[model samples]
Each structure stands twice: as structure tokens, then as C-alpha cells.
Target: MKRTGKRIISMLLCVLLASALSTTALAAEDGKVLKLAFTDSPTLVIGDMTIYHPSYAAMLAFKGAFEKSTGGEYSVELYPNGVLGDAASTMEQMLTGTITGSTPADGALSAFAPDIQVFTIPYLFDNPTIAYDVLDGDFGRQLFEKIAAETGFRVVASYDNGGYRNFTNSKREIRTAADMEGLNIRVQDSPVYLEMVEALGASATPVAFLELYSALQTGVVDGQENSCVTTLGASLDEVQPYCTLDGHLLGLAFLVISDTWYQGLDADTQAKVDEAGREATIAARGICRYAEALAVDTMVANGVQVYSPTAEELETF
Candidate 1:
């Protein structure tokens, strides 16, 4: 009889514990949990044992700030590596408030906001400071407001997507445009990139970023170009043997939140979100200065031949 009673009490305790756990889970679900998406686009890298790409680092900083400022009532869940979906799909989700946020490439965003194309012009900014000035000035503010009015994705912050893009290949050293001739180079799925590749004397091949690594590995393309952080993050450095610091396009990434979602948040929460975004931008830039130096050193250490051509040499392309 005592054994039976003890067993019954044990069952009751188990049921109570399960109920408590379920209630806690439900409460957490009821809280504001935001889904922020970004791809593996390169940025300033932070790694010792493991690398945290710039975008992920910015996301982490934003998440930590936002959650702390909001007393842990708000949480950010990152969807990196295109797990939530491709750039366009995730941007659509942000508009509909299906996903709360995303920081897609400015090239990808240009399709929705045509004004962004101007920034993609080759060698537009002479240096990173000028790029920062333009992006953080009235021009950037006006464009963000216009985009929010048009697309429902409101820009909270903008950060450099690594430094100026450089050329990389498995085939040959690229000191001039003549070296780029006939090279089957993989370009982003955008007209600006296609035009740039063509102008450089290479046969431009459009490829989805997700498929780029395999394409390069399988001899689908002979070369590609992007910032150093991007090359390392994508592990393209392992397959590509030569890197030329061409200093082409000045890349940008926009941290955008859904208008509908932002509107739903309380004024204080909204302010906190904006503050966190700015903090992330600052943090990312600081990391980039150090990261660029380290990234090049690491690639060289890994046996990738690094070359920096003179401005006159680059103009030949």
C-alpha cells in the first residue's frame, strides 16, 4: 500500500514539473521574438578558435543590446547562411512582417530601390571614410526614408560589406585588365556586376552565391571578385590561389526592420532598437579596420598569392 502511494505521488510531481515547463515555454513564445535574416556576405572578421564574420558579429551586438535594453522581453533570432531563404525571399518576408528584419546586400536591395545602383559604380568612393560620409549623411537618410515609404522594410542602420572588392582566381596573376581577358569570372546576379566584369575583359558568368563555391571548385568559372572578408568567409580562399587588390566596388549592407513590426513595438522599444542598430554599425566598422589586415595576412599564410597593383596598372583594365 505504501509503495502504491509513493508511486502516485511521484506521478503527480512529474505532471506538475511538465506543466511548469510548458507554461514557461508558452510565455517565452508570447514574448517579442524577432527573426533577423542575413546571408554569409563578408564583413570584418573576428576569430581565434573560430571566426565570426562581420555581419554575424554586428547581428550579435545588436541582439545583445536589444535584449538587454528591453529587459530580455525582446529576443532576436538570427537566420544566417540563407537558412530562412534567399535574399529576395527574405526581403519579401520582411515587407510582409513574416520576418522581422534582414541585412541583404545593397546590390540585391537595388532591385527594390533603384537609387542604390549609383553606389555600385566601380571605384565610386576613393576611400572608406568617403563611403562612410556618403552612407551616413543626408543621402543615406533620404534613401532609407524613401525605401521605407515604398517597400515596408525600414533601414535601421547601414554598414560596410567588407572593404573595396578585389579580384581572385585559380588561373593566373591579375596585374592588369589584360590579365583578366577571357577569364570566365563569376559575377553577382546583377546588371552592375555583369557590366563591370565585361568592361574588365572577362566573360561574365552569372551565378547564385549559394552555388558559387561548387561552381568555382568544379571549374565552372576560373575567377571571382569580392572583399577579403567575403572570400575568407565563403572559404573561396582555399580554392583560389591568387588575389589582386583591385579596390573595385565599395560594398554596403543595410540592416532593415519591417515597418509593421516596428510600429507594433512601444516607443521605448523602438528607440532601443534604433540605438542598437547604430551601435552595431560602429562596432562593425572598428572590427573591419583590424580585420582587413588580418584577413590578407591569413590568406597569404594559407598559400594564396596576394598582389596589390598600382592605380595606373588597375586603370588598364
Candidate 2:
């Protein structure tokens, strides 16, 4: 009886330790390993290899640069496939310095800086070029600063989450917003996404990401919108038969480090971290292009009909 009681207490302690986001103690106890976490999908592909997610590709690039720049002082350990938790949970860990950094989508980042909604506005930029130029320029830098000020995160980069969100539905091919009348669209459980769908003349239905496939299959929603990287990741192409390249929202993801954790680093180390992050950002674009191509190809192969809407046509939506 006494031994069983001790074993039970030990198990409880282990559970508590895992639940706690106490990175300082962890860093000190486990050597100089930095931890990072993100969702499972084509991004990390359930922690498997594929490298189809831009953020994951950036993470891979950052790993090597970080090791080289840090002079072998710190090594990164990843908890991919949402093993650590969802974007929101991981962001909490990062902010608390329980983890080193993260690259959640702009929607997730909005939880930190609500102004991020500005980027999510439909048709904000004409193309990826314009989006990159603006985000890689002063406007992007200033916004990152604002994010740091408002939230306790030192945002390092805004890597392309790849391509723009397009319209996908099992119902019919959508060429313009006018075609969206009365369609039921699944959106993220957020006000901004709800607004976007509503603006397109569709009723917005909020559903959890993990349950989206079942929702679409069950007729809970008629359509959805997302980047190719994610559309492929969720295997939505298997269920949704039609796609229109509306290019509505430019998929932007932010890489953020804990402000307090960053401040604690030596000046040299901090510079190296920033350098690695920048390198990751630059490396990600090419990777994003490839992943997007592959995703589109995959969808087409799977029998999803894709349409490209003209700028004037999209404006009607």
C-alpha cells in the first residue's frame, strides 16, 4: 500500500512537470536546448518529413543558421504535429518563455496584437510580390514593433504561409462573390474570419480546425477558404470538389520570441538569433513556392476542379 501511494505521487508530479511551462528551470536543468512547437499538418506533417509547410521549412532553415551563429552553444528541439499544443497554446508557452519561439498564422497572432487583422483584410495586396515588398519593408518592421509593444513577444520574422486563400467548395465552382449567395462556409472561430465570409455573401459557420473535414463531409458547411499549403494539409481537396483562386487573403505567419527571454540573452546571442530568423525568412519564399505548386498539383490530381478569377471578377466579391 505504501509503495503504491509513492508511485501515484510520482506519476502526479511527472504530469505536473509536463503541464508546467517553466522554461527557465527546464533550460537550466536540461542544458542549452531551446524548444519550439507548432501545429501538425503539411507544416510539420504530424512530425513526419515532407517539408511542405513554409513555416516548417523556415524552422528547418533557422535550425542550421542558429547552431552556426550561436557557436554550438544552443541546439533547438522541436515539438511538431501540435504535440506541444495548438497555436494558441504554443503562443502562451512562448510568451511565458516555456518555449523559445513560434510561427502561428496572422489570425493566431491577432490574439497577441489585434491590429494584425489589417493584414487579413481581403485583397489587401495585389499579389505575393506586393505583399512581400510591404511586409519586408518599413511597414512590416513597424508592425512587428507594435506587436512587441502590445504583446510581450519579440517578433523576428513574418514568413509567407504560402500563396493566398482561395475559395473551395463541394457545391460548385465560384468565379466571383456573386456566386457565393446562400453558400455555407466554414470559417475560423473568430470575428475577422466570420466577417470575411459574410462580406462574400456567405453565411459564416465556425468550426474547429481538427473537425473541419468531418463538418464538410457531414454538410455542416458547404465551403471553406485557405491557402494551398493548408488546403492540402487538411486533405480538403479529397472532400471539396471545386476551387476558385480568389487570392483573397495573403497568408502571413509571424515568428515570435519571448520578449523577456530575448532580453536575457547576451547581445551577441541576440544578434545571432535575429540573424538566423532573417535567414529563415529569406529562405522560406522559394520553399513556399515549391510547396504551393505541389499542393495544387496534388489537388488537381485528386480531381478537384480549380478556377482562376480575374481581378475585376474578384472585386465583385
Candidate 3:
């Protein structure tokens, strides 16, 4: 009777252990991991230029919305401040399925989807409202489909990179195109940007975004052009004391994912991903617009001189 009792106890313990292991396995198999990366500080504040930078905030919003909406069927991981890599490298990773997604500037993405460079054209969109209408409407969907077909990558959503590109310099204020002459200006390492700067009479010097602050501080480049939020986020306003509100280019970026990974997901999951992307896009655009609206005043308080060109002065370009 004692031996039989001992045998019964052992069997019960074995059953319990097996049940625990099975539950663990099921938990592990229940969720899929989605990794997203971008290059930007998560948060920054200088004077009144407070920023929960769009690149970082949008990814966080996507992660939260996706996880909740998917009911734990999928999990999102974010790599910010170039923890994974620069914009170009991150985009390459997404293409190869090394990463699930990334937010890359149109200039960086132009390498893979040349048509995206059209956004680089100076003054392409007259205002933010128009830009949003075109990007969030049917035209944007058609463009995304075309890009997916060509590159095997899916563009999930569009983001306002800051607002509009403006010129800032360590030298004198640039109120007109003529004021740009003889200034060695830093530009993204893209042909279109180089050409645009050269056409404006400045010697265009291509510089990596990471190295821009040091380059400006050391006089490697006399000035650079970017949205006010971008300039303030990087503390470029501290180095470049003068600003010209030229509104030359509408800053834009895309949240992109591997089409292969996306297609592999079940229909329901894909829909959830798309919904998350839309939410993220809204969060990004809102942050950019808020920052831009207050950027000039913030810069002024911080000792940067800002000049807005009159219609006549603007046409001088």
C-alpha cells in the first residue's frame, strides 16, 4: 500500500510539471515580434523648444496602439537615436527583413524609391493642409502601392518631418536668396539638396545629420537648412544664430516596413498594423505642427535672430 501511494504521488508531480511546460510553450508561441527603428533623440528641451521628437514619439504610439489593438497577438520593439543604425542603414535592414520597420526621411528613402525624391523639390506643397490632403488621400495610397511593387517594402504612413525647411546660419541673417551667396551651407548627401543649395548661391556641402552640430560649431559649414523643430531638437539654434523663414521645402518622412513580413501576417493582423500606422502618423504630425508653431518664439528667446521675408523679398530668390 505504501509503495502504491508513493507511485501515485510521483505521477501527479509529473503531470503538473508537464502542464506547466505546455503553458510556457503556448505563451511563447502566442505573440509575434515587430521591431522598428529610427534616428532621433527621444526627448529634448532647450529654452521653450521642448520636443518629444516625432520620430521617437510616433514609434511609441505605434507600439502602444498595436499591442493593445492586437490583444497581445503582436509585440512592438523600438530602437531610437540610431540605436539600430542611421536612417540609411535602418532602411536597408527593413528591406532585408533584419528589422520589421523604420521611419526614414524621404531623402534617405529616395535611394530605394527614386520617385519619392519628388518631395525634395523646393516649394512642392503650398501649405501643410494641402500636403496632408495629398498624402493622406488616394494619391498617397497609390504611391505606396507602387513603391511596394517596386521595392518589396511597404510604406505604412507619412509623417511631417518637422514642418518646412528654413535656412539658418552662423553668419548674417538670410532674408533673401542673395543673402545665401558665399555661405558654405550643409545639406543632406543628396544630389537634389546639393543642387538646390548651389542654385541659391551657397556652396553646398553634404554632411551626415549626426555630425552636423560639431561641423557647424567648428566652422566646417557656415549654415544648414532644416525645419525649426529639427534645428532646435539638435540644438543647432545655439550654433546658428540667424534664421531665414524661407519655407523652401515641406519636410516629409515615411514609416516603412518589410512587405514580406507584412504579407506573411494574417489579414486581421495586417489590418491592425495599418491602423497602428495611421495612429502613429497622426501623433507625429501633431507633434511637428505644435513644435513649429512655437519654434520662432522659442528661438528668439534663446538669442537667435529670425527673419521672415516679405513677398517682394522672397521673390528675389
lDDT of each: 0.81, 0.80, 0.85
TM-score of 3: 0.83
The stretch of ten residues in a row with the least summed lDDT in candidate 3 is 23-32
TM-score, each model? 0.78, 0.82, 0.83
Measured with C-alpha atoms, the lDDT of residue 96 in candidate 1 is 73
Q: Residue by residue across 1-317, what tens digits does model 1's lDDT show?
A: 99999999999999999976675466468857788897764333423424555677778889889978976667688888888888899899877768888887787787788877778888788778888898789998888878888877788877777677889999999999889988999998778889988988899999888898999999999988888877987899878999998888878877888887877788987899889988888877766656777778888988999999887896675
Report the candidate with higher lDDT, 1 versus 2.
1
What lDDT tens digits, residue by residue, belong to model 2 across residues 1-317?
99999999999999877754464355457556778776854342311336656777677778889977765567777677898899999999887678888878887888778887788777888877788888779998898878787788877767668777888998988988889999999988878789988987899999888999999999999989898768877888888999988887887887677777777888988899889888878777777777677777767877889888877887797
| Candidate 3: tens digits of C-alpha lDDT, residues 92-130 | 888777888998888778779998876678867767888
Q: Show pairs that collide, candidate 1.
A: none
What is residue 114's positional error in candidate 1, in angstroms? 2.8
Model number with the top lDDT: 3
TM-score ranking, high to low: 3, 2, 1
